[model samples]
Every structure is written in C-alpha cells, then in structure tokens.
Target: MKAGRKVWSVLMLTLIIAVIAAGCGGGNGKNTGGNAQPGNSAGTTKTSTKDNKDVVIAVNANFITLDPHNASDTNSISGARTMYEGLLGFDENMGLSPALATEYKISDDGLTYTFTLREGVKFHDGTDFNSEAVAINIARIQDEKNNLRLRKSFAKVAKVETPDAKTVVFTLTEPYNAFLNKVAMAGMISPKALEEKGENIVKEPVGTGAFKFKEWVQGDRLVVVKNEEYWQVGVPKVDSVTFRPVPENGSRIAMLKTSEADFIYPMPTEQVSEVEGVEGIKINKVDSTIVRYVTLNTTKKPYDDLKVRQAINYAINKEAYIKVVKSGLGKKLDSTMSSKTQHYSQQNGYDFDLEKAKSLLAEAGYPNGFEAEIWGENDSETIKGMQFISQQLAQVGIKVEVKSMEGGTLSDMINSAKTPEEAKIQMWYVSWSPSSGDADGATRGLFSSEMWPPAGANTAYYKNENVDKWIAEANKSIDPKVAKDIYANIQKTIWEDAPWAFMGVDQIVSGSRDYLNGVKVYPDGSINIRQAEVK
Candidate 1:
C-alpha cells in the first residue's frame, strides 16, 4: 500500500510539472490574455498561395465528429469546417459574413430568411450547390428521425422553399432574432452524400469547401486535401492540411519546436516564454469567446442548495486560478459569456472569501468538508484546473476527489444519463465558447430547462420559470435593445443562482511556422483553414 501510494504521488507530481509549464491567449469576444503579449496582428496570415506544401497542425484534443449537423465540440466543428462551407460564416471578430450564400435578407417580423446561393459552387462529390442543396441540409437538421444536434436550434423553421435554382427561403413558426446566426452555423453538406451515406455521413463527410476530406484516423489525424476543382480560385494555398491530435502539452510543443507540426494551438501557456523569441516561429494570440467554469449538478444534494452553490463560487480564487492554472494567460470570468460576446452585460461576481464560504457551508449543515468528486478532461491544463478547484474547495470544508477522463469518455458519462436523477456527475470543470457568436448560443443551451443531458448541455439541470420565459422572450424579440435587457435579467438571475463556479476567459494562444500562413483562430476558438497556405 505504501509503495503504491508513492507511485501514485510520483505520477501526479510528474503530470503537474508538465502541466504547470503552459502559457497563452484563451478564446474570447473581448480581451486577450490580461498580461500576455499580442505576438502579431490577429488576421495577418498571408492569403495568397506561394507553394503547394503540406501543412500540419497539432491540437490538444481529438475531434468528436465531422458531421456539421451533429458536431457539438469546438474541435469537431473546426474539423468539419475544413471541408464544409456554411451558408454564412463569421469574420475574425465573429461578425457575420457571406460564405456559400452570396446574399441574405431577413423579414421585418424576423419570421422569414431568404438567401441567394453562391453561383458555380460545387461539392467535393462534384454535385452542384444550389437552393436544393440548402433545402436538403436544412431538412436533414429539421428531421427528428436524424437526431441531429442542430435539430432544436432549427425547430423554429416552419417551411423551407426552393423557388429557383439560386434562391432558398425559410419561414419560421415565429420570429427568431438569431435566425441569421443559426443559418451561419449551418454548414452545407452535399445532398448526394446525404442521400447515399445517410447515417454514415457522420464518419464520411462530403462538403463544398476549399479542402476535401481525405481520411480521418480517429485520435491520430484528420487529413483534408486541397480541392483541385475548388470554386474560389487562387485559394487553399496548401496542397494538404493535416490536423494531428496531440493531447499532451509537452508532445505538442515539442512537435512545433522540432518542425514536425507547422502550427499548434493553446500554445502551452507556461511555455510561451520558451518559444516567444524562437526563430522561424510566429505566435498569434486572439481575443475569443471561450469561458471556463465548473457546472454543479443542481439536481443533486448539497449542490441543490443555493447557499452551497454560492459557497463554491466564493471559495474559488479567480485571480490565482488565472495565474496558476492558466499561467497568467486568461482573465477572470465576470459573466457566463465573455464580454466580447454580443449582448454581454457584466455582473458582480462572487469574490474569493474563504471565511464566507465556510460560513455558508456551515449554514448548509456541513461544518466539516463534504466529500465530492470533480470531473474534467484528461489533459494537463484541465487536470491542473481541477486540482486548483479541489484545493480551493478544501479550504471551505469541501473535500473533492478529482477524476480526469478523455473528452469522449467524459462526454458519454455525462450524456448517458437518461434523466436528471441518473446523472452521476457532481462537478465538471470545462470551457465553452459561443461558437454561434450569439448570446442566445451562450445562454439558452446551458441554462434552459428544455435543454438537459442528451438533449443539450444543461448539465446543472438548472430550470427557472423566469429564465426560461426570458430566453423565449429574448429569442422572439427583434429589437436588439429588448433582447439585451432580457438577457441581462437572465444573466443576473443565473448569477445569483450560481449554477456554475465561473472560472476564467481564455485568450486563444497559437503558434505557427513563419512559412505557414492564413490559418486563424476565430474568437469562438474554432480554427479557420479556408485559406491556409505555405507561403
């Protein structure tokens, strides 16, 4: 027993050493890392192709799925983006931009959206992209039989019409202010592939983009080759782009240093100084919408009590968490979404007060720390964050056992629960970005009662009559000011409810070879390789 204990301690200490050696920008809509240097201008990657060299990018997590209609994680969405072009897209700062759709218009009532499909666009499968393709993609998402993640968001669609080869119109059941944003989130998949591949399309993706999916060796690499017959001329500067999933921080950084990987993201925060002045390498730090937090399952005991939830928030030291866990590359999370997100409003956050946390715990009938488990992805930085939470909670009479699982495993564990009562999760240390670039994207899926477990990401099982109503009211509201006001109310109420221990906002820190250009990280943390080049 003693020997086993020593071995376990040694392994943990080694992991801490490797993990604490991290540094960078986190994803955000507002500021980059508080004190981290902005290595270069955010979107200065060269757009023109100079060479047909293959580019390699190393990321910290494996992609979950490539099917855009069902992609739930950022990495998976990014992987899908390599081969898929949405009707609309986001600019660097997350402003809506035209992609497959050349022009779009919204009705005054916000119930109808009409788009002019880009002319001469062809899918990797050689099928023409037109209004019919758009209708097919929307139908796939709207069909409940498909069980797509995008189904709920598109449920408002009452009808999709293809009046001509180039025009697509959508009529919603009611006014939805975010219809345009949701359209941007909908990536265009080949109608041919959809009809033939069916459910297999998740693994075998066919789309109309600058790149075409070559192969995906799960957990190893997802490779996309340049489309020789791409519609947009003089684009896709590289011959091929290979995304390698190197989860270990040390391994990923080493690949960048040894020139094995042309680029790496989440440039280990603690190791940023080590690579800042290195030759032949460039770092890009961008303000993003990524925010980290720990979800406390409100359906469970202790966490069910508002006082207990508030105590956990008070117990965490936000500033120290940024410095220690994030290696000073992040800002304390002030709201559920980063200030960069649209309709963001700040609120008074629970400051670190160990005494107050203890007092609250005592009032909740636990004078001594209660034993609980904290869950996180099995990554160096995530484990460190979980450890930091564990230590902070211990000071306030909360004894937490940290459990780290792979991203897919952790996701399955949380989502496998058929109901709230079946969920075994106590706390989950995770990060989220409003990839859709809307406050509704940030708030609704996470806090709405209609979204729970397999349905959506409301892991807290947080349900409030007013919050639910405000979400609906906000969605139906066409006026930005009215939506802002309703969102503010929702934020304030949830802030008081304390369903999560708001951690910090991340600045996306990434490193690229000087020769590798045009790959940029969006404010939502999804990597854009539409114009990747080996200059």
Candidate 2:
C-alpha cells in the first residue's frame, strides 16, 4: 500500500510540473488566426462544395437524457437545446430573452406572469403550439408523479390559465424573482407527444426547436435532423447534426483534426497549442460562468470540524490549479458562483498558506492531519484535477486517496446515501454551471439546506441556518439591489466556512472546422445550435 501511494504521489507531482511548464511556455507562437469568430459573433467559415449541412460535434460524454425538464448535466441539456426550446432562452451572455414566448409580463405583486405565445408555431410532430400547449407543458413539469428534475423551480406555481390561444397566465403562490430564468431553462415539449410517450419522453423527444430528434444509439451517438418547416423561416441552416460521445480528450481532438467531427467542446486546454494553426480548424475561447470546486463533505470526519475544512481551503493553490489544470485558461474562483453569474459578488478567498493550514489542522485536533478520500469522474481532466488536489492537500499532512468513477456511478454513489452520516463521500471534485443565469439558480439548488441529495445538487450536505435564510430571502426578493446584497453576504459567509475548496472558473473553450458556423456556446457551456450551419 505504501509503495502504491508513493507511485501515485510521484505521478501526480510529475503531472503538476508538466502542466505548469506548459502554461509557462504559453501558446506556441502559432497564431490561432483564422476567420474564426466568437460563437455568437457574426461570420462564416470558408464555403465548401461538399454538403456542409451535416455536422458532427464530438462531446466528452454521452447525453444523460433528452428530456429537458429532467436533464441535469450540461451535455444532456445541450442535446435537449438542439430540439427543445422554452418560452424564454438565454443569449450568449446568459441574459434571458424571448424564444417561444413573444413577450411576457410579471405582476407587481410577483405572483402572476402573463405570456403571449408566438403565432403560427408548430411542434416537430406537427402539433400547433398555443397557450394551451404552454399550459400543458408547465403542468407536466409541475406534476408530482412525473418526478421531473427541475420541479422545484416551479413548485410555487399555484395555477396555470390559458385565457386565449395566444395568451397564458401563471399564478404563483409567492414571489419568485428567478421565475423568468427558470422558465428559460424549462424547455417546452410537444403536449401530444408527452401524452403519447409518458415517461418515455426522455428517449423519444418532440419539441418546437429548429431541429428534431432523429435517432439515439445510447453510448454511441445521438442525431437530430433539421426542422425545415420550423417556425423561424430559413433558419436551422443545417440538414442534420450528430453528437458523438468521445470521452477521451486525445480522440476528440483527433476527430476535429481529421474532419471526422466538425466540432468538439471543452477542447483540452493543454492541447490548445497543438491545434492552433492547424488547417480547416479554429478555436473559440470565451469567458464562462462554469465554476469547478472540490466539495468537502462537511458531515464527514475531520471535514466535520470547521478548522479542518478551512485548512483544506487554505492548502489549495487556486492560481496553481488554474495554471496546471486549465493551462491558464481559467480564473481563480473567489466566490461560490463564477463572476459571469448574474448578481455575483466577489469575496475574499483563502490563499495558499501551508503554515496557516498546519495551524488549523492542529486546532482541529489533527496535528498530523487525517486520511481521506477524494472522488471525481473518470474523465481525463477530472482525474488530473483529483490528482492535483491530492498532491496539494498532502502538503498540509492530509493524506488523500483519489477515487475516479464513471459519471453515472459517481452520481449514484453521491446520491445513494439517505443521510449525511450514511454518505461515503469525503470529498468530490466537480464542476457546476448555473445554466438558468440567475443568482437563485446558483445558490438555491447548491447552498440551500432543502436541496440536499435525492432532491437537489447540494451533495456536500452543507447547511447553515443564516446562509439558508439569506438564500430564501434572496430568491423571493423582486428588488435587484436587495437580492444582490443578500447574495454578497451569502458568498462572504460561505467563503469563510469553506464548505468547498473553490478551484477556478473555466474559460469556455471549443474547437470546430472552419466549415461549421452560426454555433454559439453560452457562458454556462451549453452549445446553442439554433442557427448552426456548415457553410
């Protein structure tokens, strides 16, 4: 066991040094120069005679589910976005805007929302989209038996009314300032399809987006065909799109280089230099709202002690993590939410201080530190991240065992525990993006006590009465200033409590062939292919 531990330690140290060296070396003088523009920017790649309408995007993971209302992971959400859209949608900057809904208004009391549906819209299955359709979709999500993943976002809805074919009214039991953002995330599905498919909607999806589901060969690829009869005339320039899950970083990059795939998300930051100046390829780097962190299971031993949690936070070097893990393509996270998140407030964060960490360990009654395990997904980047964390924590006498598991297995492991004491997790290295683009979206599902596992994403089992109260107040406050203040306080308190070893905010990076155009990646890392075209 000691020998194995030594070998693992050596490997982690070597990886950290190599990554730091790569970052220091900088982008290999090769200009990533091309007609490449931001995903949302106006431009097109060089035209090709070949059928450019058929595009393939190589993603790092398989789609968890196609049902937008139940999907949680980003990959699944991206798949849902290809063929499903909500009454509202997010722009490149993650700002809410109209999509299926032409216009909407919220009452002064914050209990009512009235929306005017777009006229003459039709679902992929040829069902007419009207106020009743919207009402049906909303009811399906709010239904308790269905067990939708985002039901909490609409739990307060008291009633749904369709006054006319074009107008829908929503009456809330109480104020919810984040309702608009939540609506933007609740992608609309065909009412008829829902009735026919029932729980099978996750596999066979039908929506009113620019694309329609074609085929899904689980673990292989999922395909979507263009909705030629789409509501938006002349849009959805692509004929078909195929999403392949290539979990290996090198393979995904190779697919981009060989034209086997037109695009690849989360282009390995370490390989940005290798792909730069490569023919028929371009890279898109944009500021992102995605934040990565190590969740310290506050209910576990050692971590149960406040001083130990704070010590772990101080032991990690955020700047070094950015340099090594992300190749300097990210910023050190100072708050729970990324700076790109709406109403985010920066707070003072723990700096790397080995002496301070040691002192805290002693105070926590662990002068020699304690042994613990760190969990993460079995992806290349996630493994590296876990190793780096293990190496960093070791510096402060904390012996960390790294366990990387498959995505689904990890989810089951984290959620299987019925109570905090039963949870086997000691720490988990993970990433989160508040795709809803609201402060409540960032806080409520993550920091709120009510969002514990089996219910929400608060896997850390972290709870604080003051923080919980603040989150509640912030979610209901219609005033922006009040919400901002409450969020600021939340950040400050959480940072001090150190429930997580806040890592860094990723700079969303994706690569594609010059022929692929009109594809935009939101700050939350979900790709928007509404206007995607292979030119």
Candidate 3:
C-alpha cells in the first residue's frame, strides 16, 4: 500500500511538472492556454481570397445544427445566433440588449410580456418579420414530442400568441422575471420557411440577423453570407464568415499566424506570447457565464454520503489548481451557478483543508480512503481539473482511477448512468452555461430531482425538498429583485450540502486580425459580426 501511494504521488508530480513545462514552452502557439495578449492594432494579414469589398472571419468547426429549437453544441448555437434573430442579444459586455424586438413591455402583474416587432425586418428569404413567426417558434420549442433540448427556460412558457401583426405576447404559467433573458436563446425564425422545409428547414435557416446561412460541411467548415437586407440597417459589414474545426492547437495557430484563417474562436493559453507578439493578430478576453466544476453522483456509494462528497470537495485545493490549470486566468467558483449571475452568493465559498477532508472521511466510516473511478473528457481543461482533484483527494485516502474518454463517450457515460448506483463515477468534470444571467436558470434544473434520469442534466441525482421548493417558488417570482433573493438562498443551501466542487469561471477569449474592428466579444463568447468590417 505504501509503495502504491508513492508511485501515484510520483506519477501526479510528473504530470503536473509536464503540464507546467508544456504551458510555459508555448505548445503549438494556438492560443488554447488562454494566455494570449489583447488587441494588437498594427499590421494586417493578406486575405486569401481576392475580395476586399467584403469581410471574412474564420472559426473552428462547422455548426452541428441550425434549427433554433434543436441547436445543442456551442458551435451550432454560435452559428445560429449569427444566422437567426433573437428577441434580445448580449452585447460586448454580455448585458441584455434588443435584437428582433424593437421595444417590449411587461404587464403590471409581470406574467405577460409583449414585444413590438421591428419594422422593415425581412428574413433571408424576404419574408416579413411579424408576431406569427415568433408564436410558431415558441410553440415548436415547447412541444414535448419534439424533445427540445434547450427548452429549460421555456418550460415556464404557457402560451405564445400574436395579438396583432407586429405584437407578440408570451404568457407564462408563472411570473418568470427571467423571461426576456430566456428570449435571448429562443431565436426568431420564419413561419413560411418552417412550413416549406419541415425538418430539412435546418439546412436553410432564414432570419433577420446580419448573417445568412450559406453552407455547412460537417467536421470541416460552415460558411455564411452577410445579409444585404438586414433590418439592423447599415450594420453587418462583413460579407462572409467561415467556421472551421481545427482541434489541433498547432494547426489552428499555424492558420492564424499564416493568415489562412482570419480569426480563431478560442485562443489557447499555451500560445499566448506567439499570438500577442505576432504583429497583426489580436486577443480579447471576457468573463464568460460558463463555470467548470466536478459534479458528484450523490446517489452512488461514497459520494452518495454528503460527508464523503464534502470530504472530496474540502480536500481539493481549488485556489492552487486554478493557478496551475488556468495560469491565474480563471476565478474560483463555489456556487453551482456562475458568479457572473445576479443572485450569486459569496457565502458559499469552500476552503481547502486536507485534515478536515480526512476527518470527514473517517466520520463517514472510511478511515482509509476508498477507490473510485474519476471519469472526464480528454480535454486540456478537464484533464487539468481531474488531475488536481485526484492529487488532492489522495491526501485524504481517496484513490481515484483516472479514465479519459472522448467527449461523446464521456457524455454518454454520464447521461446513460440512470440510477445513482449505476451513475456514480467518482468525479466527472462538467460545464454549466446559463442563458439567463440568473442562478434559477441553471441551478433549478441541476438541483431538482424530477429533471434527472435519462432526460435532464441533473446527472448528480441531487434531491432536496427544501432546495426544490426554493427553486419552484423562485421560478414563480415575477419581480426580478425578489427572484434574485430566493436564488441567493438556494445557492447557499446547495453550497452547504457540497453537491459539487466548483472549479473556476473560464475566460472567454477570441482572436482576430488587426483589420477586424467592431467585433463585439460577448461575455459568453457569443459575438455579433454585424458591425465588424474588414479594413
């Protein structure tokens, strides 16, 4: 046993040294490490195509799906957000801003939200933007048979009606103050186009946004043409945009440096100096809504016991891990919901103490640590997090067998685990991306037991009557201030229970050429190319 521990310790030390060494050495210079310098105004990359009249931007990966209701992956949503129109949008600061809806009003009771559609708005197909299209889009998303994956917020939507040609009404079952924030995800689509294409409609999306869907080649590239009829009028200066999937850091950085690709979606940390020192390239960072954390399978042995879960969390040196993994770019998060959200409570922060963790394990009847599998996707961020957890947990007698799998396989492992017994895979690294900047938006779904099993994202199987009631009541709160208070309480309760060991808030980074200006870098990494023009 002593020899085993020594071997594991050496292995972990070696891995940590390797990661630090590789990070410092500039791995492939792809900007994956989140260390790139911000906005270099000098020099310019020659456009590969001889079209200086229009703008062309490049990203990693073609969109997986364009259908607003069905879009899942960030890549697809990023493309759709550009090609389609939402009632509202997040600006460069990621604050709520208007998009399709020119002006909107809430009822005195706050249950009804009425939106006045923008005039002269035309879909890519030239269909008039009106309330009918908005109504249909909402109806389709709420359809249970269709199994809309992104309908977490829309579950509260009772009905969507068009009272007038230009007026759209959203009637909620309860007064959900986050309704407008939710609308940011529910992009407006054309009713006529949906009728014409059916399921195939995703292939050709029509919206009033500044960009129009052109073509998508899976695993390779997706292209979009600028909307000449964009209702935003004078905006959308870019002529075209292309998203290419370059998983390899070396290749992505090579493309960015050589001017083959105008911009890379995420600038890795390892290549910070290369991109920053490069004359024409620029890097911008924003505090994203996404938070990385380890979701505990509370239903399974060891983790099923709150004491054990707390021990696992207490044993983690999150502050040190953040420095090592994020190179000090990431912020420590203790709440299940993001700190960027309005209702985040600082009272939930967890501190590291290996002695406390060991005592908790002993109190939970495991004087010596138990062995369990730590499952996570084979990504730089995920691996780094798991490594930290594995090393820290070892100090408290927990033996973690690290199993790295492909993203799809890891997701399947977590989703397919039906019961806590079947689902307990020691530690799993997961990301939480909230559409609405509210804790209720992300926490309610994660803490509620009803939303779990083979369906919802609550793979943790964490259930609490008090937490559930708080979430339910918060969902019904019509006033924003009231709802925020309720959610703050909910975060406190969850933190005390230690359902998850929150890691860090990732920095949303973007890279572009010197000529690209007015490129709005959203806090959640969603940017509006409407105002971006190539000089």
lDDT of 2 by residue, 136-251 (tens): 88888888888777899999889999989999999999898999989999888898998898888889999999999999987688999989889888888888988887666666
User: So what's the TM-score on candidate 3?
Assistant: 0.86
- Among the numbered candidates, top lDDT falls to 1
RMSD values for the candidates in order, in angstroms, are 7.7, 6.4, 5.0
Better of 1 and 3 by TM-score: 1
| Higher-TM-score candidate of 2 and 3 | 2
lDDT of each: 0.84, 0.83, 0.71
Clashes of 1: 20
lDDT (tens digit, per residue) of candidate 1 on 96-194: 998998898888878889899889999999999999999888988988887788888999999999999999999999989887888888899999998
- Which scores greater on lDDT, model 1 or model 2? 1
**Ten consecutive residues with minimal summed lDDT in candidate 3?**
33-42
Error of 3 at 385 (Å): 3.4
Predicted structure 2: lDDT: 0.83
Model 1 misplaced regions, further than 4 Å = 1-52
